[model samples]
Target: MLIDWFTVAAQALNFLILVWLLKRFLYKPILNALDAREKRIAAELADADAKKAEARQERDEFQRKNEEIDQQRAALLTKSEEDATVERQRLLNEARKESDDLRTKWQEALRSEHQSLSEELTRRTREEVFAIARKTLADLATTNLEEQMTDAFIRRLHKLDSAERGELESAFKAASTPAIVRSTFDLPSAQRSAIEGVVKDVLAIETHVQFETAPDLVSGIELSANGHKVAWSIGNYLASLQKHVDDLLNVPPKAATKAIAPPEQQANG
Candidate 1:
């Protein structure tokens, strides 16, 4: 090592200058670039973390919306099922009511038809019985029957009470035309004379007489003065007999026996 103080001093100064230049131009610029790159990388990492959090929130929200839609669909299905059940019950009730109505109408129609048929049968039976009775009586009629009827008429006129006699008298007096004496058959002169005499005696009115034959009387005498009438007929007896017979046939056994007993007793008496 040489001991040269002036030369050493100059070399040391040169080495110091070189070290300052290297620090200012090379080391300082490299350090600043590295620091700027690290700051940029940190900012990018923070932005990536924020975007990841937002994506997770959107995924959670979509899941929740799907669950809500499922609940709404279930509720709608339940409501539709309930409506269908109610509608089915309403239709069943309406059908049952209509069935009942139809059944009632059918029963009523049946009853009406039965009643009509029964009434028609009863009417025809009554008419036939009446015709038979008329024919039988006409066949049995005779001169003796006529005589008896005439005599009965005369007796009835004689037996008239005061009120009936007065009514006949008033009718005869009010008549502008002759009083009519009608019978089913013509009468003999003697019977007519007798009837005229009895009318004059009982009623005490001198009235003209008109004797006429009316076959519709069946076996009867009918006298008409003004609007008043006096009549006696075998048809009345026949009608009473027919009614009694009808009652006996139509009634129950016990009732028929009791009804028949009365007529038999009356006839015997």
Candidate 2:
């Protein structure tokens, strides 16, 4: 424990020199190395942070793009569905119109055929009736029928009204050709003379008369002067009967009555 100041001072000086040498050589170089390492690590850390931010931005962009793609897909699907519906409706309308047109055409065809059949039936019936009437009349006594017809014709002339008498008188006076008297059979000389005498008396004129046989007269007698004619025929009666039949069959009227010429050529009287 004895105090020694000189030894203590010397040992203190050696300790200070050793400390300065270590600070200048070892500690300063080690500190500089540590600082360089820390700077490198900080730079690496900053780079990693920047990379992470870029990755986040890319992810966000990708997510937004995915959402936009989904919306576009949905819109396309909806449009496709609407278009399909419109097309289907158009096709259905076309089909319906075609069906209606076809049905109408078929109905028209059927109606036309029905009318044609009705007309044919009416024609056949008329021909058969005419044939039957001709046969029946032919089978009757020819001489008696002729005599009766002549008497009837003479009676008709006598029974003529004022208008009928006047028309015949005028026609006889104006006619350049002889009056024609037609019948289904030839008139006997006596009947012919009687008819001529009556015609002259009724017309009150001297008129030449010509006689002609017309088989189509069908048990009838006709007197024609100029364009005027008067007749009584079974054909007229048959024509009236045919009119009734045509009405019953719902047939349209035709120029089927040939028993008399037009009013300009014949008088009903």
Candidate 3:
């Protein structure tokens, strides 16, 4: 019931003073520290998040670069393979062309060699044949060869028919112009008479049969009349043989022609 104003006043003042001390020392200081801690934590978390994002970006960039490098390597390998294949084909083609050229050259060489061999063989054969023939003919030209040939020719002339006899008479008459019979040697009396009788009998015409000795006719007879001359002589036969001897011997012209030719002819004067 009694009112104590001073005590009430003093208590009120004490309570206000306590409130000020709490606000200034305990409450204010605790609040300030908590705020500072929260700010520091937020800063630290933001820094960590930024670092993680940077790491992820770096990993993605590295992967992309690696993929690009792989693609470039694959392309280079493929190009190298194609180039190698092309080079191999080119080399093979070149080798084949060279081989073909070599084959053609070898064939040509073989053909030329064969032709040369054939020509040589032909020439040798011909030479051998002609040499054999010449030797055989020379052996047949014995001492009795002239008598045998003359007798045989006369006998063959006797075998002629009437029409052939008339032809022979005309031939002989036309062939005896100067009528001077020449001989290589003096004939026996009996032989001369026999020859005259045969000529008169066969031709049925006779004038005179004259004889002269001449050694140049090589032991054969010659008759000339009109524009014709008939000669049966060894020298003439030999000359005819010499003319074609090169072809018969099958030797080169220079060799065969020089070997058997007359001295004046061989000199080509």
Which predicted model would earn the best TM-score? Answer: 2
> 1-269, model 2: which lDDT tens digit per residue?
67688889998999999999999999999999999999999999999999999999999999999999999999999999999999999999999999999989999999899778756654565456645655655676433556667888888889999999899889888999999999877889988999999888887889889999986565579999988987766667666766786665554344335333488545653
How much is the lDDT of residue 61 in candidate 1?
Answer: 95
User: What TM-scores do the predictions have?
Assistant: 0.43, 0.44, 0.39
TM-score of 2: 0.44
Q: How are the candidates ranked when ordered by TM-score, highest leading?
A: 2, 1, 3
Poorest 10 consecutive residues by lDDT, candidate 2: 251-260
lDDT (C-alpha, whole model) for all candidates = 0.79, 0.81, 0.65
> Compared to the true structure, candidate 3 yields what TM-score?
0.39
C-alpha RMSD between model 3 and the true structure: 19.3
Off by over 4 Å in 1: 1-143, 252-269
Residue ranges of candidate 3 with Cα displaced over 4 Å: 1-31, 120-269
Clashes of each: 0, 0, 0
What is the total number of backbone clashes in candidate 3?
0
Candidate 2: which stretches are off by over 4 Å?
1-21, 120-269
Model 3, 103-208: lDDT tens per residue? 8888888888866775555445434433554456567763343343345434644666788666656766775443444555565565456556655676677746
